[model samples]
Every structure is written in structure tokens, then in C-alpha cells.
Target: MTIMPNNPPIFSTRKIDLFVPEREELASVLQNGLRYHFVEATVEWVDCPDLTQEPFNLATSGLCGDAVISEISGMSYLFPFMESEFQYSIKRIIKEIYNNFNNGLIIGASICLRLQQQYLVQLGELIMNASFSRITEDDIEIINKSHLAFLDETTGRCALESITNSDPHCYPHGNFFISEGKPGQVLKVRAKKRIGLQFLTALQYSLEKKYSSGIYPKLIGLGGTFVMKSGRARHHIMPYNWDNNLTNARSIHNWLHYCDLDAPLVAVGTLLSSNLVYKDACKFSDLEVCGLTETHFHTFSSNGAAGGHFYTDLESMDPVEYLGYFYPARIFNHVDPRPSCNELIDFTDVMRLATI
Candidate 1:
């Protein structure tokens, strides 16, 4: 007698891990980001004093809500306040997870904010490796100065400034030191000594080694959180630049290629971040699958296309999903309209893939 066989879906687990070392810190970072930008963080993997405290409501001109979790479209979210928030949130989550899961972990983390992608990726690299750096005096100075600007605003908007400054416990003091959870010592995480690109590369290399040996897990989760800024030097939509630059795209492409090079192949693409949908398609290069962004969601969703990883539209394939930052381009064009010809040129491939 002949027997029929069944195949498991490419991705089926859709549980995203959300965390906050405490509520106040989380609220402050999230609220501050929203005051400056429209989008909010979908997840907070790591919690720092700066990104944890609740911001003052006075800044909203009486418009701000009490909690960081605000409702929109019938869903609650942590709004994007500043670009830096993205990096802080992503790094925290990744570091916490990596410390616990190590190489066996395969999920990816992302900030819902569109502009913070670059910084988010930068911090992710730091988290992947067990590295920490002390926050510089200059960095502290800039943060304080920014807070002052927030304070200079009018009374009705005083709440905005308060939120930015509310987390006195975390900011400079919290960031300068690390946790003292180790044995025989109250260790502090130095802000100066941090993980860099080499660390991330080393991690990838290590993961590849294990995957090749068939000792690694096939599925992983991805998500992150951060603030947003839109006025001058640090524009609100800056994070999305990573999406257009082909950074993640190339990464996925390379990852897929690595599999061809003989490593155990793990399906790539975002396990989280909703709006950015991926079209399922046939796998292409390792980089294509390994490296990804919100836009790549399209290519990721396409069923059986070519160029990156396995072919198949991972459409709503759900592992865990979240986007800590994003903007409504349709309505805020003046601030974040479609990129100019030059900018568009930089992201052609990513744009083509995810329809971002």
C-alpha cells in the first residue's frame, strides 16, 4: 500500500517576546519618541533606565496619554520618540536574549520605526556578541542638551520636556554602568567597551559553524523597539535607510549562499514586524535570507521567487512580529516623502523586493 506524506508549514510560531525591566523606563523612552515622531515601537527586547521610565504628559499640550501603550487602529503600541530609542531598545532585547539563548537562538529582532533600522541593526551587532561599552561624556552631554531644548518649550508643552527628563534614574547614571548579576561581584556594564561589527561577524561565523554541524535550531524570532526624531540632524525617518541600502538584503543573500557553501540551511526573513509583508519565493543567496528588512517582507512573502533564501511566500508566516518605529508617509510626505531620485537609487533592490 502507498502512503501519503505531509509537509510542515515554513513558519508557524507567532509568539513575540515583549519585555520592560520596569514600566516607568519603558514609558519614558516610548513616549519621548512619539512626541517627536508618529510611529511607536512594537517591542522592547531590552530595558534600560533611559528607555524605561515614563515621560511627563505635560509635553503633549494636554494631548498625551498617561501610559506609553497608546491605542490606535484597535491595537496598543509604544510610539517612536527619537532615533536613539531604536538602538537602545534593540540592543537591550538582543543582549538579554543572547545571554540566555546563545547560538541556539535563531530569531531576528526589529524596530517598527522605519527610520531607525540602521541604528537598530548597528545595536543588534553589539548584542549578538557579549560586549558592552561605557557611555561617553560627550554622549551624555548631548543627551542633556537635548533634554534642555525640550524644557525650553512653552508651558502647555512642558509635559514633553518632563517626559524626556523624567527618567533621572536611567539616563546618564543607568547607561554608564551595566548589571551586577554575576557571582562574587556586583559587575557594571561599561558603556565604553561595546560589541562591534567584528563581534557580529564572529557571531555569524560561529552560528554558521554550528548550523553546519546540525547542532543549531532551524527557526528564530525577531523584533525590537526605539524612539524617533524628525527635526534636523537626526530625522525621524532615518532608520528606514537600512531597508533601502540593501544591508539586510545582502545579509540574507549571503546567509543563503552560506547554506550552499555547506552550512545547515535555516530559513531566513523576519519572524516579526507586521506591515512589511514578504512574498514567498524560492531561495536565492544566503545573504538574501539571512539579511532582511521591513521591505524584504515582500520577497519574503512571495512563494517560490528567486534571489534570496528558500522560495515561498512566507506571507504572514508568523513567528513573532513587531516594528518599534514607522511613519505614515502618505500623510507626512513633507517630512518623509518618497526619497528623491538619488535616495531612491540607493534602495532600488530593497524597494523592488518589499514594495516599501
Candidate 2:
């Protein structure tokens, strides 16, 4: 008498639905000027691994935390901010979970500091050195007599006085409606819209046609957050920062190989900007994990490896032993610096063959 077969469900019950944008629909999309605002989230599938091991933190558990988890490549990410918000709402909830998490396996995510081109060329050289050292030559002759061409009609006041005197690579790149102060207290300065890679490849082709037919419940993991400027005064601007290039780490390894999602992508930033963009996008792709925060390994003294894991406080972790020690698939090809007790017995034999 022999009959053996009945497993596949170590614990699986996942659902995280979040779509925020109300406050009069974000003040009518910023009074119709529309810089960019849209947040949508939907997840359903429940068995229960402590809801992906106690995730939701959206910075001090606000936007209804406990579903927004993180791990990265060794795979273990739920989604949503660790912290920071207010009309920038955790950078639009990390760009709507990196443009709608494509169905299954997404190891190591986090690439969108507005699609980092050296953090938008150091935020356009700090807004052209704060508009040429806090502008004034009567604020470029009241912006070239408000004729508004922004300059260069026979060297428009010598190209607005040579961009406050030389070397922003000798100015001239069109659009420059600049301004400063001392005339009824003017201010103006624009230059913050730079999310093109053809708008993240048409937002991953409309989130792969709204999750084609997996309906949504397999984006394994993802993370990212950065917003620096910090010269300091009363905290002059800083938010989970990090920077590194090589064309923004090969455009996050070519947008995770153009979303062929199979899972892992983490870069929560800060704590040395998520270990320098996860060590420069693992020197061009092959990143299975790098979700950090043991104060980013004690502020970078270093010691969290096995692809890198340290979620010290994603609101008190332990979602079924951090997903039974990062489920398995051989710990997404573990790099080994740590994590070995036979990889916790191959992550409890891949959560007992995922509770078949």
C-alpha cells in the first residue's frame, strides 16, 4: 500500500491593495498643472505567511502599514515606503511599486530616482548652482524684461550675464525662465521633471497590460527611495539618499531585463544610500538581493551579506521567520558572506515544498 502526494502550501496568502491620491484627488492633480500623481495598488491571494512577514510601514506605519515589506534580490519584498511623504508620498509610492509589479519572480528591485542619470546629473547641478548663486543682476534684468524668451536675442544681456559669470559649461541649453528676489519678492526656478526612458518604457507598457492575466499577486519584491540636497539648516532636504552611475546602474539592469520578472530588486536607500546603489547595481546586473537597514550595516562598517539583508525595523520583522529565511531557489544563488546552516536546511526545504 503506497500513496504519497499532497503538498504545496507551506503558507501562501498575500494581498496588498493600496491606491492613494485623495486630498481632493491631490488638490485636483496640483490644480491641473499635473507634474505627476497617480497611485494604485491591488493584491489578493491569502493563505497567510503573516502577510509577507509583517510588512507595511510606510514610514511609521501610516498609510496603513503591514504589507509593505522588503528584502530585494535574495527575494523578499512587499512594497511601499519605509518613510517620508507629503505630496511626494514616498516618491509616489516608489513609482507605483516600480510601475506595477509584473506577475512572478522579481528579485532585487529599486531603480527610479526619476530613473537616475547620475541622479539627474546631480539634479541638474543643483539647479544650476542654485540659479547661479541665488540669482540677481536685478535678477537677470527681471528675467530679460519679462519678454520671456529667457534669453539670447543678440546675447540677451550677454546670455543673462554669462549665467552669473561663466562655467555651467558656458550656458545655453534653451528653456530658462529663471528668477530670484528683491522685486516684490520673486522666486521661480523650475527644473524637476525628468522621468523619461520614454516614460519608463511607457510605464512598463501599461504595467504589461495591467498584469495581463495573473491579475496581480506575484511581484515577489521591490524597493527604493532617495531625495537629497542636504546643506543643512533645519534639515535642508534629505530622504533615504544614495547615488551611483554607470548609466544609473545600467538602467537598473535594463529595467530588470525589461520586466521579464522572475523577482528581487531592493534599494531602500539611506544608510549610505542603500550601500551605494547596491554596490553600483552589482556592477551591472545579477543582483538577487540588497534590501538594507541595520542602519545600513552600522553606517557602512559592513557585515550584512548573503546578497545583503538587514530590515532591522520594517516595523518589527518576523513574517514567518522572514519568509522562512528567504524562501528558496537556493537563496537565489546565494553569494555567501553569511547565511548557512545549509541555508537553513534549504530554507526548510523551500518552505516544505511550499506546503504542497
Candidate 3:
């Protein structure tokens, strides 16, 4: 593998068009106004004038989720959600994508059972080593309490105040339309490597590990696309957090410069709509980004209905026996059926049989 840089790569000019047939008005507001605040990036938001010109084909298609990935410079980025109901129409598109990937089409996507924009962004940040900063226990608690409200309070005018009070060069903005969950959504952490938990815990863990190892991890203040990357992670976990709020970690870096190392230690956050965009971005740049995925090949929930079956069926043995089940569930799990004898593997049996 190539030694990719661990910093956020700079983006060159790329043409992006907004496709919002479902929420055209919202799309217009976001495309015309919101894009300007996020980056020094050039973009265009066009009204779907074809809606009136074309017949509306209302079909009850079974759609998992959808993602559009772009590849450049050997890295991939998941495209941002186009703010449309294309979710219902992406299955056919994904098949084309799958075929394209096989045929060397640099950009492609997969139709997950329940993929979302937030998940895409989280995955993208990991793929791209964007800037990030650590959060404190207090910060974590506050974020857990009222994240969306925190987002609302900090976006635009609130962000301006935050940047002024913290750093002159830093200004954050909130894209309200990209909001993920309802305010009442309960935010809690299970065994899964949640983005909220990762952003909160990874930095914490890095600090703890650093200190214990007699090395202080440096604190880096990530804003703009950087912090937005963390937000991507936040949305990826789909934690039942009440609100989405952009927090500042630059303060921590400025205040505590000694408790760190030469390697930049930062906590980053961003509000992204999908990993597909991030994946595509990776293709155009070279960066080392890390996000969370299952380590255990056949990991399953330890508390869900499937979890019970996982242990019982294996007679309390290894996890990879029915690993494909885990992947599908990770995408989205409404129903899970055990594999047939034909699907079971001999190597799987050996692990369990040896343990027995």
C-alpha cells in the first residue's frame, strides 16, 4: 500500500450539481446559500426543471439505501446526498455501479438496506485524514445532552460568535436541512463503535493511552470540512442524540500545548450527508483516514434477538461461521435468518470443534 499522508488533502476544482426533486425548495436554499459558507469550493445548485417536463413514475420499488462514490488518485469518496428521494430509485443505479466497479469505472456505489448520508460521511472521514480535535468528558456530556440544539445554537450567527471567541481564523456553519434525527432521539452507546463514542472516546482514549505511555498526544483544532468529518462520524453511528452541535477543540489545543506530542492530536467534527461523497473525495486525494468497522469477522449484537441466536447456534464458539449475516445486519437489520448447512463452512466448524 502507498504511504498516504495523514493530513487533509486540498481539493481542486470539481463540478457538483444539486439534484433535488423531492425537496426542490430546500435544495435551492441549500445550493444557493449554504454551499458558500462551507468551503472555498465552487458548486452549483440547479432546479430540477425536468420534473414538470417528464411523467412522474410512481413505483413501489424495494430500495435498501443508496450511495454514489467518486474515485480519484486511488482513493474513493461517497457522494453527498442530493437532497432527493432518489433512495427509492437507486437499486437499479447500484447494479450499474456494481457492474461499473467490476469494469473499472473509477466511481461506484452500493445499495445498502438502510445506508444514510451520515454513515457515508463518517466512513469518508476515516478514509480521509481530515483535521479533528479531542473532546473532554464535560464536552462529551454536553454534546450528548443537546447535540442538535447545540448545532442550531452554533450554526451561522452562533458559529460566528464561537469562532470570534475562540479563534479569529475559525468560523463554523450549520446546514440545518442536513439534520439527521429528531430532537427526542435518545443518544446512547452500546458495544458498537459509534461516531459520537469514537469522537468522544477516541480522543479520550488517545489522551489516556498517550499519557499512560509517557507521551502526550497533541491537540489539534479542526474546523470547517475537518470538524464536519467528525459530524460525518456522528451521523454514521446514528446515535439517538437529541441535536447536532459543532464543538470547538481548538480551544483545548491553544490552552494545553504541553500535554501533547509532535504528531498532531486533534478532535474533528463535521455534518456530512453521506460517506459516498467522502469516498469519492479520497480518489482525488491522498490521505490516511480512519473510521470504525467491525473487527470480529462475525461480530453480532450481544443483546439483540440475533445475538442470542448467534451464541446458541454456535454452541458458544467462534464468530466467523455466519459472518455474512453480520455484514447485512450492520447495513440494517429488520430480519435475520440463519444460513443452511450448505452455507456453513468446515473451517468454521474446526474453530468451534477445537474449542469444544
The best candidate by TM-score is: 1
Worst 10 residues of 1 by lDDT: 328-337
Q: What lDDT tens digits, residue by residue, belong to model 2 across residues 1-356?
A: 01112121221111222222222332222222212311211122212122111221111111111223322222111011111111112111222332232111111212111223453311110111111221322221111100010112232211111112222221111111111111121111111222221111122233222321242311211111111111100001112232232122232222211101001211121111122233233333543323222111100101111111112211121211101111101001111111122122112132222223
lDDT of 1: 0.18
TM-score quality measure for candidate 1: 0.19
CA shift at 143, candidate 3, in angstroms? 38
TM-score of 2: 0.16
Model 1 bad stretches (over 4 Å): 1-197, 212-356
Q: After superposition, how far is residue 191 of candidate 1 from its true place, in Å?
A: 14
The residue-by-residue lDDT of candidate 1 on 1-356, one tens digit each, is: 11112122321111111121233333333333322322222222222232122221111111111111100110001111123331223233223322331211111111222212354321110001011222442112111111111111123111111112211111100001112111111101111111221111222232223222243222111211111111101001112122222234443232211101011111211221221111111021111111112221111111211111212212232221122211111000000111122222122243234322
Clashes of each: 138, 35, 51
Which scores greater on TM-score, model 2 or model 3? 3
Query: RMSDs, each prediction?
Result: 21.9, 23.9, 24.3
- The 0-to-1 C-alpha lDDT of every candidate, in the order given, reads 0.18, 0.18, 0.17
Better of 2 and 3 by lDDT: 2
